[model samples]
Target: MAYRQGVTELLRILASAVTALLVAAPSLAPAQSSQPVLEISGASFRPLPIAIAPPIAVGDEAAAADEIYEALTFDLQVSGLFEVVPRKAFLADPREPVGPEGIAWTRWSDVGAESLVKFEVTKGAQGPKASFKLYGIASQRLDLGSTLEGRRADARRIGHRFADELVKHFTKEPGAFSTRVAFVKRAKNSKEIWVADFDGRNAAPVTDRGGISLLPAWSPNGAELAFTFFKKSMEYPNGHPQLWKANLGNGRSSAFVGRGDLNSGASYSPDGSKVAFTLSTDGNPEIYVVNADGSGLKRITHSEGINASPSWSPDGKRIAFVSDRHGTPQIFVMDADGGNVERLTRQGNYNQTPAWSPRGDLIAFTARDERIVFDIFVVDVATKEVKRITQDQGQNEHPAWAPNGRMLMFSSDRGGKKSLWVSSADGNVQRKLGLADDGEYTDPAWGPFTK
Candidate 1:
């Protein structure tokens, strides 16, 4: 009953908005009688053209409005669902009102925008409040709209929230813009673990103790991170990598598995109760599983060749890892207890960093082609069909799937520097994430959607 009531109210709002537009701008073309179904995923998908008008700042909200606008624009462009129209081609005045009566629908149409977005920022009781509206130009309908209030310092988050809502309107699944991404940013003497927004904004170091922390993996609930820390002062005191856990709340960390000669590639189980990692306590590297608290340690793989990069399946019944037992490092899947081992990738001779999709349908990984250039690829779990996601984009590696499995984040040298980049699941849309820091970013771990 509540769902129906919300839909009824949305229809009423759209009716009022469209009626005002038609009456105020009668010379415009009549609204289309029908709308096309949008396909945001799959191979047949085409990006929808949308126009995001300049934000209308009210009172002293000009700065906050600009920040929100920039964030919203970036999210839309990188979403792979919409092709944002450049503001330089806009024919309408920039100061136009967001109300339906004042919108120049014909101008937006001339600019080849099927949908239009209008944002308004006002001073809220505590900080800044924003109002967002999405209009279907052809149908003259209000497709989506929301009003949100947040701290002025978090204006960017307000924009992210609106973008998530917009994506949900079209795909029924919310966007991953509000999520965080953990990555390794290499410094002169240390490779520190850092966390930032999905788009690489508001980055802050998670570990500042001046050592190397690699392969940052988020717990399913996002309350903690599992990584490999290398330091000479640990129990081993040998500077060997050891699995560690960090509480994101208090920024405290402790070794999770320190007895092994080397422990790395920590992948949290779906339920966040366990972690599967690679340990070299034996003569060679092998996949191992341990409880989240470092108890019940068990080796999962026993192979002559190295076995590493253990990624748990969504159902927790299987684990995907990399193995060179067949003479080439390739993706392999085995039961959680290391039974029924089966090779998953058959093409590339050098394939590693297999990231299981949250949907459990695909596993994204990095491979070196015949030309020795690294690229991202995904293999279907059922069909074993491999699809290349990046090509000729410089070296790209360490693919990590978003929580919804609709997108992936990896590191790329495409811009002449190694940085974080994100792409759609089908590789149709790709964009480089913007980070202010000047250093190589790698091993990107896209966190789960925030509460």
Candidate 2:
């Protein structure tokens, strides 16, 4: 049965190519703007200036321990929340405290160091253990101290956790540098789903069977995934593509919706009781709400034109979606019950794939250059101001916000092929995720941390 379903989806894709072209007409033009707006906010307090002394080596010599220290130092510097002072300027080693006075606070202040990070690497039975201490120059006291144990192979992860703790003690927000990303990859005739750590390590495929699997949406708890798959050859066999759910813990999966013409673009609500999805079961693609268990299906939009890609607001009272009821695809907001539809994007000729941020203050979506390319953009819900997050790249689309709403993940073809990329919510730090050979990753939905 699954084999037949896969073949049917492929026929639908070929048949829908003409309709897609018609709906995507206006997107073929180049978007023009005199200047682009970039969002930047100032921190409430000045960042602390700190120094990290070279780690003190203990026992036998080991190159892996030294490499771990170097990577940790680099992580702290790139976070942009700290100013690291040079270790060469330290007058005394932390291994020898100058008298009980705890080193000279005046000397550190003179050298422009407001804090100090001293670490000692010791060989343990299991592996290496790094002991660290943080000292504050202003208070003239030790602020924090701890020891972390890990195998030499996991040295980088240990370092990242240590740096995260330091940031939390000072900034009051957990650092996002240790998170992970999940995305879909497609190359030529092979399609697979994968998950990787934030730094693009330990990438492994979750699915081995190659069929037309697309549009992966992570559950709020990050334990399950909802996506669309094409497995049959019949033309619109059961109405639309089928939706399936996969449980990451046990590798169990099952069909969620199969009676529709197209059951794609599914997202879980913040509270996790319901799912917002795009369905064409009613003849025209429209936004629909259904229980997470696939019961109590309810249509939310009654517009005459195409309406799809529904994303629930953080409060769960409203939903953001893409609609062509205005003659072109644009972002629209509607009540969860399908009342009070309002247009959100007036300037962009083609805007689609609306995703509400978990923070509840903004909505991110893909805005195409009415000429030839697509880029990610965000809209402030209260102010109604729009900010383009990606510049001229091959094609950037399918944006999903992080759990904290401080970062976003999307797919782009900038490096000559489609790959997943992540950026700060403000568009400051943008970087690619996944191996170069992974090939054409798309539809990245950032999931919440499970542990």
Give per-candidate clash totals.
Answer: 0, 20
TM-score of each: 0.90, 0.78
For model 2, the superposed segments whose C-alpha errors exceed 4 Å read 1-118, 123-127, 135-141, 233-240, 434-436
**For model 1, how does the per-residue alpha-carbon lDDT over 1-451 read when each residue is reduced to its tens digit?**
9999999999999999999976555333223333354776576878889999999999999999999999998888877788899999999889988866677788899999998889899998879999887778876666666899899889998998998887877777868989999999998888999999998988999998687889999999999998999868656565878888889999998887987588889999999888999989767999888899999999889889999999999999999999999899999999999999999998989999999999999999999999999999999999999999999889999999988888889999998879999897778789888897578899999999768
Candidate with the greatest TM-score versus the true structure = 1
Return the top candidate by lDDT: 1
TM-score of 1: 0.90
How far in Å is the alpha carbon of 103 misplaced in model 1? 1.8
Per-residue alpha-carbon lDDT of candidate 2 for residues 1-451, written as tens digits (9 for 90 to 100):
9989989998899879978865533222222221121122465534457877667777852464576566566556545456677667776655654222446667677878877776777887677888777776665555677788788776666676787777666665666656666778787786767777655566767666567777877887778888887656567543347788888888877788876678888878888899988888668998888999999999889888899888989889999999999798999998889999888888778898898998798999998787768999999888889998899767999898876676788888899888888776766557776466747788777777556
Give the TM-score comparing model 2 with the true structure, all chains together: 0.78
Candidate 1 residue pairs in backbone clash: none
The weakest ten consecutive residues by lDDT in model 1 span: 26-35
